[model samples]
Target: MRQIGLVIKTEGNRAWVKMQKGASCGEEHCPLSSSLIDDSQDDFYTVCAINSVGAKSGDQVMVEVEDLFLLRTAFMIYILPILAGILSYALLNYFLKIPSLTYTGTFLSVGIIAILLKRADRKLNFPYRIVELGTASVCISCPLKNRNEQQKLKP
Candidate 1:
């Protein structure tokens, strides 16, 4: 969805865009939210926003989200550790009949699961969209590159 709004607020790397109904005619209206993706953050390296629309404060700009699922998956990685810990404890106690080793096994399983899941998510793609606040343009895009392209670019 396109926001076609102005920069109502900006703190650090995030910006909130004010949405307009039809066109921006200098009137107060609903506002939408957007964030500037910084390449310094590895996760957002391939999702950098192309600022060709000349975005500025009070200047209607557009923002886009390329991969929504991938974004959600990133968050899931955080929860996996907790789930793994509990599952480990339960499995050891119930299946293996090893109650005494539950706690240690639980923590170890959590660490392992978290690391593995994080790596997996990095290699997958999430549902994404681009929000052009200024032009009120939104495009669903993917951060994943084609296997052939990757092979060609690799050293």
Candidate 2:
């Protein structure tokens, strides 16, 4: 998937971007509109992406997520549990002749797989890269000066 974001910080060829929400995602009803990153404290979420085009802070750019990675993630989330349950039932009921315990085994296997996948989630960081740069000069809240201004306004 592709997204438009502002480069909030750049270091060692990686850019920390704040992705735009709503129509900027090119979807009328985007599912990721409310998704937040690790350090999101405002309207937009931050992501560290590969700086393919050498984008700098305040530069608006386009970032693309790997489609294959998305497909693999979907399969793991949607299909793996079903497969585990079916295998559990087949082995427990058909091979072991324990009809009474088939459903229990299936449930247990699925639960175990879910726990494993949840733990695996931490290691999955799909690559996002800058594909194109936009002409926008700066973001609505940027240049570090705006952050300082907001701090002074607090009572």
Candidate 3:
């Protein structure tokens, strides 16, 4: 999915982008809505992404993040642990024949796996990439443009 953002900071080949609030495809039921990070205070969210488009600080750019990556990460972080706990509980109960030991084993295994995944995430890089540098013409067609125009018309 694509998002329009301002390059708030740049470091080497990466940029800290403050995401603008609006759907890239201008669809109310966009699939990316669930994955897109949002902030409540300023209607903007920040993310560090690869600067493949050579965007500089203060420049508006389009960033792309794979939907598959988001779904995979979510599955691993949320679903995998629950599955692991269930499997561990079943196995322990069958082998040890003790309900208490089964619960303990399940919890301990889930904790260890969660901690290891957290460490692994720190060592891995995100799947986001900068796709293009925004132009004045791009802003004219942006979804936020209509909102801005409506606000101006209000007063």
Candidate 4:
């Protein structure tokens, strides 16, 4: 999915981008809604994105994050633990013949798996990339357009 962000600052090969609020995807259960709302609240929260496109501070750019990556992340976070738990329970119950230890084994396996995954995630690179950099469009109802116009009139 594509989102617009303003380059707020630059350091070396990275640009800190302040993401702008955009129209929802119309999904009834959008997982990104909470993050999007929080990001829109203030420029305090910014993403340090790769500046491969040569985006400079004050530039408006389009950031593209793959939907496939998002889906995979969601599946890893939500489904992997349940699968691990079930497998642990089955192995403990059938192979070890310990029916009483099934729940304990399941919970322990899930916790261990989650901790390992969390650690692995820290080493993984983000799947999103900067696709383009361009001017912010002006429209009659665009709030950013008004802000830009005001900035232009200031000096």
Candidate number achieving the greatest lDDT relative to the actual structure? 3
Count the clashes in each prediction. 25, 0, 0, 0
For 83-117, candidate 3 gives per-residue lDDT tens digits of: 99989998999999988888899999999889988
Model 2 lDDT on a 0 to 1 scale: 0.73
* Per-residue error (Å), model 2, residue 77: 1.1
Which of the two, 2 or 4, has more TM-score? 2
TM-score for each candidate, following the candidate numbering: 0.41, 0.69, 0.66, 0.66
- lDDT score for residue 23 of model 4: 24
lDDT (tens digit, per residue) of candidate 1 on 44-73: 112223444445555445554445554576
lDDT of each: 0.46, 0.73, 0.74, 0.67
- Report the Cα RMSD per candidate: 15.0, 6.9, 5.7, 5.7
| Model 1: residue 11 alpha-carbon error in angstroms | 29
Which is the winner by lDDT between candidate 2 and candidate 4? 2
- List the lowest-lDDT window of 10 residues for candidate 3: 146-155
Which of candidates 3 and 4 reaches a greater TM-score?
Answer: 3
Kindly indicate the candidate among 1 and 3 with the higher lDDT: 3
What ranges in model 4 sit over 4 Å off? 20-45, 134-155
Summing lDDT over every window of 10 consecutive residues in candidate 2, give the lowest-scoring window: 136-145
